[model samples]
Target: MVSSRERIKAFDKKLLKSGEYSVILSRLPAYIFELLLIVIATSGDKLSEMDVFIVMYAWGLTFYIAPYLNIWENRKNVSIYEVLKSLPVNQWDIFKVRVEYIAKLLLSRFLIMLGLQIPGFMMTGKILKENMINSLAAIGWAALVLTIYALPGISNYRSNKQIKWKAKQGGIMWKKM
Candidate 1:
């Protein structure tokens, strides 16, 4: 039987292999489009706090669709969950590893988007303090909304050993890996 730690590592790798990289790469076009929108939106003028907020918000919202897209792209394929479910590991172990995979992906997206937004922020002609605060605030709100959206799944983990694969409301939609 594989150790839980090893199983967790395998699950993470499965997730990375399945479609995360491709999903992230596919987002490049969307990012470029949003950048163009921001440039056009603020053409010939310095950006207001609202403009900064809109850009940061769009940036945050763009990457937010990545994980879901990854999941959807691999929906017909056999998931790591399907593979691990018959193994010796406990169900919670599988569920926790899945959550970890999601959290890691979200964190990476947040960092990547934030880093990519710095240039846009600088272009706004705003003071560094204002840009930093607004960027942080916008990212923070996006993070909060993402967390709230995940809360139902997290709470479901408390009552159920295995993550739900059903599409019904209140059911966890994330497939393994």
Candidate 2:
């Protein structure tokens, strides 16, 4: 039997090998483009400092929301989660590790968004340093709100068994079977 420590390490390795990360990497450029478009469309001639900051914070928060939603909605796509579920490892441990992984991913995106904001702040004549606190606070609020939305989906996934999918004339749908 594998020890808990060994299982944890293996789970981490599985996550690394899963190749699902490419999804995030591939979408990154589109994210940047979309942000730029939003700025252009909304600002017209001038962009407000607070508006740009809100956009930056929102883009940062999307990092967390996207991954967690992917995990909860399509758990099977993440092979590490499957292995962890099958293993003797505590479910809570699996949950914690997944949460940590999500947080790490979020931070990476947050930093990238912060970097992009530099040019934006410069263009708007807003000092990034001066507005740093407010931007951070907005990021924090985004994280909190997204987390609140995620909890129910995770809990529902856990409490229910045999999640089922059905196809209709209109679209694909899922429900607890």
Candidate 3:
């Protein structure tokens, strides 16, 4: 008998496909990478300081927004409120899954980049001096922003569930300041 971990692995192998990643990656800031590669090629053998700045800028632009994509995705294609109000599972599960997916996808992308960067950094250790602290700060700030954006949807879902439950018991839900 396969263990739960094996089952999860099978499920992931089925649901997470290369084509799906291609779509997700396309939605991300691929253009920035393309531009960086072009500049590197034109430089004729090595990247310069400006190349490092460009890479950092690209990451800065994309990193923060990565965590919040779930919220944006939901906003663009909001789950039906009417349907959610009737579901048996707690309303938060839907938001939780979305946020989880975003985190997973972002980490996947980050891992891929880190895999590539480790080799590149090894080759030119000088560029490694770029402020790691700033990148970390950006990540923290972006996560905070993503969480804030998600709050509204999660709150909406929770409020809807509470209201539906109260109505089922013939009680009115009230909002107090």
Cα deviation of 5, candidate 1, in Å: 6.9
Ranking by TM-score: 2, 1, 3
Put down candidate 1 lDDT per residue, 23-132, tens digits, no spaces: 66756754664565355333322224465655555445534443432243322323333445567767566555544545565466445545544665567654545544
Judging by lDDT, tell me the better candidate of 2 and 3: 2
All candidates: CA RMSD (Å): 7.9, 6.3, 10.6
Candidate closer to the true structure by lDDT (higher is better), 1 or 3: 1
**Per-residue CA lDDT of candidate 3, range 1-177, in tens?**
755444434443453453365436544564565345444433332333344654454454443333222212311322233334464444455445545554664455444444444556666563533423333333344444445444546545644555566556765443321
Candidate 2, residues 61-138, lDDT tens digits: the string is: 454334433343353222234434555677556555555655665566456556666677767766666444544554
- Checking candidate 2 for backbone clashes, the offending pairs are none
Which one wins on lDDT? Answer: 2
Cα lDDT listed for each candidate = 0.49, 0.50, 0.43
* C-alpha lDDT (0 to 100) for residue 129 of candidate 3: 33
Q: Which of the predicted structures, 1 or 2, would earn the higher lDDT when compared with the native?
A: 2
As for model 1, its CA RMSD to the true structure in angstroms is 7.9
- What candidate 3 gets wrong by more than 4 Å, as runs, is 1-83, 127-138, 152-177
Candidate 1 positional error at 177, Å: 17
- C-alpha RMSD of candidate 3: 10.6
Question: Given candidate 3, what's the lDDT at residue 137?
Answer: 38
